[model samples]
Target chain A: MIVWLILGAAVMGFLRRVDLYDAFSEGAKEGLKSAVRIIPGLAAILTALRILQASGLMEALQRLLVPLAEALGLPGGAAPLLLIRPLSGSASLAVLEDILKRFGPDSVTGLAASAMMGSGETVLYTCAVYLSAAGIRRTRYVIPVSLAGWLAGCAVVGLFFR
Target chain B: MSAALFLMIVCGVIYAACTGRIAAVEQAVLEAGQEAARTAWRLAGGFAFFGGVIGILEKAGAVRGLVRMIRRPLRALFGRDTGQEALEAISLNLSANMLGLGNAATPMGMRAARLLSAEGGGQPSAALCLLLVINATSVQLMPTGVIALRSAAGSAMPAAILWPSLIASAASTGVGVLLCKLLERGGR
Candidate 1:
């Protein structure tokens, strides 16, 4: 799909008589600069996330949310996926797999987890990378608003898929 | 960002100490740093590739064409104060997201955010905040990854989540936009 998009872009550039190679390399250099610029922020955020995950704090938070999950008509086991969804994509994916394996894919918990994972984004990672790359210091309600969206998605998933 | 990170690390360390897992936490921080570097390296390749494509599009006036196509809706959402360049980049980011092209989405999003910031006189604009919220509550057309995983895990109906996920995604995006609108008004 992306390959097709690139090919189409090249064709479009060719028809426009643009210096496609020069344009590409110039843009690619900027891309590299921005990518490199994000490393420090990624390191900080990921290290903190890793600590949260490794020290079992993530699970502890999941445990605390289990009752809320159950109250929402989801299984207690689905709590981890919900708690971790905005934090880490890979972690939430792993939790989704764990839920599916334990509860069966067609089960209510499994379906809800799948839907929730499907709809949600890694809010922390996205905010950190984008804001840092943009060189913005103050986040200013981005996290709160994003997390509210995530919670809304999760609730919808629970209400419908479950 | 610092406050969030500080809280995470402090809470994590305290929790680890209470559970006698401080050694594991130390290991995790070291490993995470390396992992982050590795992740960044992988992202560099994708960004370069997509950036090149986007460059071609920009030079060919394709991006401008796209911006024109979505100009009204985007203007309505982001307001008239935003520049065309930011709107173009934002559209790219959003289309990639809807297509579930995460690797493509991030670079475009960063570009859009940067452009928005510049347009807002270096402060984070309402448009930028809206973009962030929308990205964080991505409206994917299909949860292809999850469906694939479900099928691999031997599910009877792996595609069952397709509509449900889309509905949930739309709901979140709607709510996010509403919240941003309300918050922008309140903040003003």
Candidate 2:
């Protein structure tokens, strides 16, 4: 995939008479800089997520949300992922890893978990970072809308997995 | 976000304390940052590689052509246009996301957000909201990472989830787009 993207871009660059090497280096520099800039926020997010998971908060919530999950047609085992997938990418991936570990990846539970991971986003995390980058506050209607979208995706996953 | 973080930490610690699982809390506090650091490095590596490719694409006018190709459908979807730069950024970001290059998509998405924010007079417009919503509910064409995870976990058919993922993601973005458009019209 990476090879195809580069080759395609390089061919396009050649056709357009652009200096591909120079452009590539420039972008790489910016990428490194962005990486540096995002570290703190990412750390905070990850740390908080780990705490949430470790504290049994997620476990408790899972129990609480199981009925809701079933009502929405999701497997009870999928409760944790369905909740977290939209909150943090890495966190949910960790949850997915755990699910795959416990349930066997080919199990119905695992497929449902994978589908949830595949479909959703790190909604709150993405908005916080992007809005912070733009120095904008008062995130109006974004969280609700995205979460609604996430629920829609979850429902679809439930339909198939069940 | 800070408040949410603070609450999670405090509540988590208290919960752990109450449940005699304080050790887990300590471990989480000590280790999560390292995990984040490692992930940041991975993301940076990807960004560096894809950024170079995207840089080449941008300078090549390829991004422009790509934007022109999608502007009609996008504008029809969002009901507005910001400008060429913003459009290019969004197109590149969306394309990268669709191609499952999330690391590449972030920088491009941020570029689009920066542009849209600048133009929105401090209050993010409906278009900007739609952008964020669409991004959050990204429609995946390929989900390589999940497949890889499934393979690693010994799934006999790792690719079985592919079509399901595509349908779910596509349906998600579709609903998200419609909700944003409705809200946008209502806001106006």
**Highest lDDT against the true fold, candidate:** 1
Q: How far is candidate 2 from the true structure (C-alpha RMSD, Å)?
A: 2.3
lDDT of 1 by residue, A40-143 (tens): 88898899999998899888888899888777666676788777888888888888888899999999888888988899998888888888877887777788
| Per-residue lDDT of candidate 2, residues B60-99 (tens digit) | 8888889889998877765565788888888988888898
Identify the leading candidate in terms of DockQ: 1
Model 1: colliding residue pairs: none
Shift in Å, residue B134, candidate 2 = 1.3
| Residue B16 displacement in candidate 1 (angstroms) | 0.8
Model 2 regions lying over 4 Å from their true place:
B1-7, B20-27, B30-35
TM-score of chain B of each: 0.94, 0.85
Task: Please give me the DockQ of candidate 2 compared with the native complex.
Answer: 0.65
The candidates score, on chain A by TM-score, as follows 0.92, 0.87
Can you give the DockQ of every candidate in the order shown? 0.73, 0.65
Across residues A40-74, which tens digit of lDDT does each residue of candidate 2 receive? 67778778777778888877876788887887788
